[model samples]
Target: MLRRAGLPIGPAEILAGAEALSRIELGDRQQAQAALRATLVHRREHFEVFDQAFALFWRAPSAPGEAEAGEVELLDKAPAAARRVSEALGGGASPAPPKVEARPDMALTVSAGEQLRKMDFEAMGAGEIAEAKREIRRLALPLAARPTRRFRPNAAGRRTDLRATLKESLRQGGEVLDIRRSERVVRPPPLVAICDISGSMARYAQILLHFLHAVSNDRDRVSTFLFGTRLTNITRQLRHRDAEVAFEMVSHIVPDWSGGTRIGEALDRFNRDWSRRVLGQGAVVLLITDGLERGGPEELARLAAATDRLRHSCRRLIWLNPLLRYAGFQPKSQGVRTMLPLVHEHRPVHNIESLRSLVETLSAPQSRARMPS
Candidate 1:
């Protein structure tokens, strides 16, 4: 029971527990409990879990054709442990007696979910993409909170807050015995995602947009913009509660969905019109593209200028390219060379595991994200 409960009890501890049980009177629950706990448990925090297992182990059978009394006692109280024990003991059928049929909808296959985590988004089929969307919904995106110029009252703050002290003094006959302190307020910076929806990036974009939608609803101050032949701000459309409805509205709003790539022009439009509105307050920008510019040197020059402006406006700019997953990838194109020096971090966004790694990188301190040489 201790091993099944995930306690660190070895064979030696098991034999020791058995010896203690043999020495103690089985009729005395208190002495037996103490002896078993002393022999089996090694940590203070695990005492409660051990106590639960002990009580369940001693329970009597309730009736015929029902679950074992031990399992019945734990099914409602310590469900996670009970479920773990059931799985460990032969398909959860032998030790724990049978009950009503389990709901088919609640059955989550563990191996299938694990496989999806490492599967590449571009290679996923229709059903796999649907399952990946469900998995994406369960993911949590945590941003690194930055300290702001604004201050809030803090009792443990070192600096004196004269304004707060004066306000509090008014209630105490204008005589202040305690001086209040204040600390700078901290908040998550805005997240701006500039995604490429060109033909080559269509499959990756669909999956990434789902991820963006999840991040958008997970926190405040998130803006999303999609670019193909032209730039379109679908931040408002993506704010819808329903993902399907949001994507449907986005399709109608964005005229160029899986069209030609005009990276320079789209970026130029964003820098000229939308940069100031969303790129303030040390924003973090996620640039999702394959670095495949269609136009000539003039367009590449424009893209370089726009990317420079974007880098200057944000605290950290991460470039996520699915092409980076290629083992023989080289920055041979003018567009790729121009973008290489501008981003703080360059990473692959080809799978769920990569996305999770991105989340971890973003949660770290800003100083940790270094510009690639």
Candidate 2:
């Protein structure tokens, strides 16, 4: 009831209130008990703390009388008082709590930081991917506000609107003082993310999907997609108020789970279909994959060329390769070598720290030159 009455009471406050009640002197025990009970229910605010204290003080088993036992049972069965209080406080019925669906306990048990150095990307499964994605979401990024150009009325900056200020001064009894001008500050560009979810990319997809969900909800203007043999737009699905529901929807939509990858075909389709649509307003593309092309080098080169075209369209193009997690990583594959040169940033997407680094890179300006042809 206190919560309903908009009174914030912690556990300590409830206990303190109970203690104070217990200490009240009784000239007549019956009268004092009646007065206390009346005080407890005088208002909703009183009932909230009183209910909690009563439950604690008179354990159902110890409380005397049939009425007291019935009250205790009612309290035990009381449809979570917090929800009622919240509703009464004008918050409405509390939102239905998320359903916790039980999945097999198949989570990977890698010790923190111990496996960061030697973790192999190819070895992780769906369960590990989910946990890894959660871990990645926990990683923080150093977000720096972009420099904005604000308009100023003073000649020291931009030209002052002398006419408006003089008019205002005249309106203030001809006083040529307290002149004011307005300025518009430019907002920083929104962050754009384009993630790849394809066949060979399936092992890394779940974690990245979680990462995409986090980015979508936490930041503004995020676009996501999944592609195996074909491209499936998942931007709308990830917009569900609940992340789990969004992902479940995505899992249902994406048909090529653990299927074959066609990087060139997917990129070509994206270039034709989504690039002009979602790639506008200075977005960043995060092309994630191992860069193994079954379509051979020609198609890989064509996709690489399209990726380069995408690079021109966006503020940044980053390539996140799980293969880069290997200490002795090399761009031996033709597809990798072809695509690497086109990206503005290249980083590993294997673990939490790597994801953290990716966020940091997104915020900072890159200094590295494009990889040599």
Candidate 3:
């Protein structure tokens, strides 16, 4: 298994591994694994392959004879990585006869990393999440630029500038023939993201925050706000080149991290204080929350007012709810019902693929986004 995983293991290493196993109590699986790894694995980079192999090989009954029987079943039920290793080692089922004109091995197989892209964020382990973060950082978020009332000189513009035409004619020895044109200036709209960091959204928030951090640094006019029981602007912190340091700084700054969800209060605060400051010049707003508002007599009223203001302030308002990933999800909660008709768009944000879709959507005009009357 070690050799198949591209590790260098010889007869001497095998003997040493046996000797190390004999020295251990063998009663504890962790102790046995440590002994074997210490004896057989010489390089740190091979740890991932070794761990997968160890899990597949050791997942059996504790009893000796029963374990041998279990090993055969384990091989049959082995995961994709273990299956590849088994096939490489020639221990798997016999291969089919080659076709007359067979395609190369490279044409047929998909890498594990490709498979990870489709996996849900909530389902990923720690290692996969770390890998996903690296992938997120590589994403390019280029928003489509919109035309402004401000103008710049353009030789081929449709609209004629009478003053510029007269000035140009004066430069041309008073020949009243040449015409000057101007075009409206184009610039990307400001992007403001209000993300939920409450207890229910804890797992997905950290991963999505990495995406936001990448977006913040990739372009200008991008603002990021995290809300748990309160709203905290992390745009400056996320601008740091180092993701770890940026997240660390955010952890220190956000006092309400993993606290209760008070969506109404957070949005009210945003509308009251931050909205006018950031949501100017036709901004795009991404509200990342599950639409699960805290209960109170004033909660719905406050949320309604805030959402209405937010919608009116932005050119497009997109709500990214992780709960929408489920096939059977419905707008059952009062908060969800209230939000459904307010936003320009509602989309899922539970995986890397979804984020990629978001980037693509942002780059294009929001023609498909359902705008409220």
Local accuracy of candidate 3 as per-residue lDDT tens digits, 1-373 = 6654545465666899999989989898999889888877764544555666786556554676775464456555544444444544445464586775856688677777777778887556444667898998899988878887788899988889988999989977999887889888889989999999876676678888888888888888899999989899998999998889999999888887656788988998999989889988789999999989967768988888889888998889999999988988988989988888888889999998889998998888656459332
Ordering by TM-score: 3, 1, 2
Cα-based TM-score, every candidate: 0.67, 0.58, 0.67
Tens-digit per-residue lDDT, 62-142, candidate 2: 445764555456446543443333334343343585875965354755554556423443333233334565666665543
Best by TM-score: 3
Q: How many residue pairs clash in each candidate?
A: 0, 1, 0
TM-score of 2: 0.58
Ranking by lDDT, best first?
3, 1, 2
Worst 10 residues of 1 by lDDT: 85-94
Better of 2 and 3 by TM-score: 3
Q: lDDT tens digits, residues 84-200, model 1?
A: 444434333435546658655545545666788887775454446677888777777788788878898899987799998999999999999789998888899999999998767
TM-score of 3: 0.67
lDDT scores in order: 0.80, 0.63, 0.80
Worst 10 residues of 2 by lDDT: 1-10
* Superposed model 2: Cα runs more than 4 Å off: 1-131, 140-143, 147-184, 366-368, 371-373
